[model samples]
Target: MSENIIQIEHLNKSFGDVKAVSDLSIRVKEGELYAFLGVNGAGKSTTISIICGQLSKDSGKVIVSGRNIDDGMQDVTRALGVVFQNSALDMALNVRENLETRAALYGIKGEAFRKRLEELAEILDFKDILSRTVGKLSGGQRRRIDIARALLHKPRILILDEPTTGLDPQTRRLLWDVTEKLRRSEKMTVFLTTHYMEEAADADYVVILDSGKISAEGTPLELKNKYTGDFITLYGVTKQELDKIGLPMETVRDGVRIAVPNTAAATELIVRYPELFKDYEITKGKMDDVFLAVTGKKLVGGNEK
Candidate 1:
């Protein structure tokens, strides 16, 4: 079994009269992509800030790679590579210059710096944009550079906070590809926070937060099975036929949707009436449904509470 790389126990944080995080606990295993999901103001950012040492927790134990954060932060910082929600690159500086500055902070100079930059450029596929000004590059291009800067020190864990928020679909796919490649090659554990349900659906494990506390935690399929139902939509089938079949169904725009207890039930219906289900689509429960079932709010779009 993989060991836990990051662990938080009974974590709590408050601001004035409001509690930002409440008795939260989570474990992230090595080389796994763990998604921390929550709507805005649900304490996602606050928890991340505390984990990154930007904000101190009220009371809790935070251990990163076997070192207690309270004992010393330098080791913790060295073990983590963070890419914040907002871009942190200098607009006026070219990619090479920006990367050079960040590399110098880690004392990687001369031959070592050049080699590291080359490796990242190849890994992130940003060699062509190294001379381009950050402000002039596209959103996707700048994001790649942001990741490169964070990875310059080759940290064991990579924390991505809303890394694909406003990018186009193609860019998002490209970013995920790079992330997966890094995970396999560098053996790094990924800690991700994103509003996109589809993105969270791909995580090895997901933890949903609500009102500053853990609402749900499991693999995507596990959550779906626990909180949602499977749907089978049949086209070119009359409502009377569905009624005669003695199954519960609802009328949709192009067809009728039947709610089944599981995939086996859906398949049984289809096998029993192959002709009736000639034109059909079977869809399992989605992450959005799981989110809605657990939290009262939607996953995307809204001002943070």
Candidate 2:
């Protein structure tokens, strides 16, 4: 078993009568890519804030990098870094200046700072934009610079809260590529929270919250295997047309979707209902399926309250 870098036990938080995080607990291992997922107002932000020492927890304990968050904040902070949703970059400063200022704040200077920047340049590929002012850079470039700044002190753990939220698909993939590579090279633990299901799919472990409580926790594959089933969607087919086959299915917007055990079952359906569907789609299962199954809600348009 890997050593846990972050441990939260029986964590509870509230605002007035509304509970933000209730009885939440998780053990995030070092060098692991952990996905912390939930819809809006699902307590994900509240929990992360408490762990980062930005907010006080109502009760329970949080330990990060072997330091209790409450009393050993200095130690915990030295081992942890966070890239929040809002851009933390100094818009007026050039990329190099931003890094230089942050390095100075962390007491890394001269040759050591130069060497550290060189190392990060290899992963973040920000060398080209070193002279470009942060506000003039694209969103993707800005985000990378933000992460590079967070890593100035070589923290053991990185907490990314919707780091790529507004980036295009290509930019998001680019950021993750750098992130994944750095995770391997630096042996750093990554704790990510995002609304993107596809991003969570690549995580080593996933924990989802709903209304201040953990709704599900497992590996992406494990969660999908347990919560979702193979299914086929017969596009351009009406439910009435499929009534002749007596297949149990739900009527979707386009047509009807029928659950199946495997390809064999899907083949059987196609064989029997050959003329029923003009077009069809077959999928084993997906993270979206697991989210819906475990939380009884959608990721994007679900009720937060």
Candidate 3:
């Protein structure tokens, strides 16, 4: 197998007059956990659908597991597995039944299928709930079932679109650990789209999409070093007092206080007027700061485009 498990070239797609994705090209190396960071409707889902052969691209070449998705749909799709934000499972079936049915659909049955199910059950901690109906399971459990279903076919590349969207912090963290284990143990190439910046932090590589284009692509540390310099957060009793700082500052509403970048000039401003900014605190640059610097807009707004 090639080092690059998935490769996209000059991908373009449109719906009527609106272009969802445009001239976007990227590559996901083997065993890489690539995070696609963008808000809702930033074309992240559209791109994933195109690559998975769920949706047709207006123009572009999508290569998955060395097969062109458009040219060899069957061959390309056979090597790819996709899990959407919403669970795609038969709620009436038990966890094991769901996986068994999926495997059967892919022409896998008998002893080999049973063995694969056993392995997945042990690895994903689904042993206890194997006989329990999926509809009766908790949200986290259902998500685990969804993941297990995706792995039943044992594809080389896996794509998850916001796999942990509504999961709790602990559950989300657990999913991250599971994904790491899959990559390390199975050498599965994982590609995920997430709005959570913290999730992006843990990825091997991050691609920030905005307006159907990639704004930044690098490791989390690399992005922080390239964009964020410092942080200037102001702790004040009131918003009026923050406004009265009488200097340019990026106002961020974190419940009560406001925050701004503590750049070199901001340091000079503090040095010149120490009394005015006595209540302010300076900290290292944050991922939020890096996002703001790159987008020129507050990260609070969920609109990535």
Name the best candidate (by lDDT): 1
lDDT, candidate 1, 89-189, per-residue tens: 89999999999998998789999999999999997889999999999999888998999998999989999998998888877887888789878988899
C-alpha local distance difference test of each model: 0.90, 0.86, 0.80
Segments in model 1 whose C-alpha atoms lie over 4 Å from true places? 245-248, 251-254, 271-275, 302-305
For candidate 2, write residues 1-305 as lDDT tens digits: 87999999999999999999999999999999999888988888898899888899999999998888878688888888888887888899898888999899778999999999998877777888899999999888888888888888988999998788878777677778867877898889999987778888999999988889999999997887689877888888787787887768998887788887666778887887689757989877888888888888877733432
Could you arrange the candidates by TM-score from highest to lowest?
1, 2, 3
After superposition, which runs of candidate 2 have C-alpha atoms over 4 Å from their true positions? 232-245, 249-257, 261-282, 301-305
lDDT of 3 by residue, 156-249 (tens): 8889898987787776777778778888888998998987777778788888887788888888878876787555766554556556666455
Off by over 4 Å in 3: 231-284, 299-305
By lDDT, the better pick of 1 and 2 is 1
Error of 1 at 26 (Å): 0.4
Please tell me which model should have the higher TM-score, number 1 or number 2.
1
lDDT winner, 2 or 3: 2
